[model samples]
Target: MVLFLYSPLVSRGVAQSPLGAPRATLAAPAEASFAVGQQLDANLAAATAPLLAQGPSSGSIVTYIAMLSSQNVVPNAPMTEARGVVGAALAGDRLVVRGSFRELSSALRDYATDPVDPPNPNITSAFHIHRGSPSENGPFQYALEVTMNSTGRGGSATGDYRLTPEQIQALQNGLLYVDLHTTRNRGGELRGILMPA
Candidate 1:
């Protein structure tokens, strides 16, 4: 009995003793709309010319500062705090798909799950949320998004595309819903909203 016990123990020890810890493959974080975790003091001012062009109203400046700073803040609890995909304002004609993730596994989850409501029939490209989904209210316009590409900080999206403008006299109105896509899955997600530029 003693020999058998010792043999098992020795085998277990050998099994535990490996050459080294297994090395995990790390995927790069998605490209950020702007530099994240970065202070918007000088760099931010230099980067956003559109904001600069709007003139120096205090409210405008304050809003711009808030927008830049909020990129680093954590989101409120109960959202997909786990590593997942993130979106950035649709810039130019293309949308960039990005995420703030520590590992590739986190970023990929967004792509696998049913993120789009009414279940996007065509998930071959970016997914879309249904117009009747709980997110929409009577006449308010919501932004629509689509993931086009990715990089190190996060990604980009194109949206707020006006299919039709809300006319004051019209009874029916349309709003934009946010949407996203994934290029490569990152294993984690970040906490925040990516507003349009």
Candidate 2:
């Protein structure tokens, strides 16, 4: 790389020519002018807002990073060798769970954001988040939206959900699990406790 010093201005307002000669002093450019004070807009504020809860309860914000495997399946599908990872974020009463799941023993089906069919056809996820510990099967709580290909869905899952105070505590306490339902094992082909990625 070649750096040709064409003309660099000295701090004293004198211009130094490339030939190592000093030129006449040049007036500094005027400062830039603005109409307004450059106030922040709503979108900028919303985008830059901190994700974690703020204030005296800020310490309660929790992040869960964990994995899901056949080993974590409550009933134990020994024949299946599927695995998954969960990443979750809890800010105040809002929680979003997202993860990737693969290597299932059978075809995936019926993934959703809720147990009942979503009112809007646009909601096309079938993954289920249950309120259970590793040792037991719990009721379905939230549904994760997953993608579909020529094959069955459940290859990946993501969903943002509003939660109650109790639900928030349960999630922080590691009492929530992701349930992957396949055609063969309707109960749950694979399971992983959710934390955020």
Candidate 3:
């Protein structure tokens, strides 16, 4: 009679029987290991590949830069030496505006000699993207509105205005312009056309 005994160690690739007799150990399958390595390499390549090479994807970001000047204001303000840069970006559902001013008057005075009080002191001014030229009157549509920082030098604002596809096209076509309004000049203190950056 032949007696056969099974050992856990032998099943796990050990080269010895339960009675300590030598046996040939089985090697791990090389093809299976190579397949695992190939799968890992493919996953890594997919993760690092660029999504967009030509331009931004839909709902991606579009940026514009504006050079602000009082001379561009509708009804043009007095030739003050105030000038600034206003940057805007549309990303997803949000619109962001950032700006910095130099040689700007912080006083609560308008273009006229009259001294006026601002409704909100923290907001030194207001910025807007208008549908028409800064000089155009009536039926003005605001594309975006941002409150100036309290420092009167610069600030930023962001909002979810859900810009429409037509609005985005208008922005790209130069049909949009930035208008800045201060306590003194309610219509606009500074103005500039938006252009791609």
Best by TM-score: 2
lDDT tens string, model 3, 1-197? 23233112222111111223432222335232222222222222221122112234434555555667887776656555556555555554344555544444543333233322433332322555666654563233443334455666444333234567777676777767776555556666667776665
lDDT (Cα atoms) of all candidates against the true structure: 0.26, 0.54, 0.47
**Using Cα atoms with residue i matched to residue i, what is each candidate's TM-score against the true structure?**
0.27, 0.59, 0.50
| Of 1 and 2, the candidate ranking higher by lDDT | 2
Instruction: For candidate 1, write residues 1-197 as lDDT tens digits.
Output: 11111011112111111113332222233232232322222222233333334444412221111121212222222223223323321222222223223222123334336344554434433323223222322222333233323533233322222223232112122122223223332211232223222
Find the 10 residues in a row with the least total lDDT in model 3.
7-16
Highest lDDT scorer: 2
Note each model's CA RMSD in angstroms. Answer: 19.2, 19.2, 26.1
lDDT tens digits, residue span 107-184, model 2: 765444333433544424446787878799987787777765444533666677788787877776778887777767
Candidate 1 lDDT (Cα, whole model)? 0.26
- After TM-score superposition, what is the CA distance of residue 79 in candidate 3 from its true location, in Å? 2.3
Candidate 3: residue 116 Cα off by (Å)? 14
Q: How many Å off is the CA of 133 in candidate 2?
A: 2.0
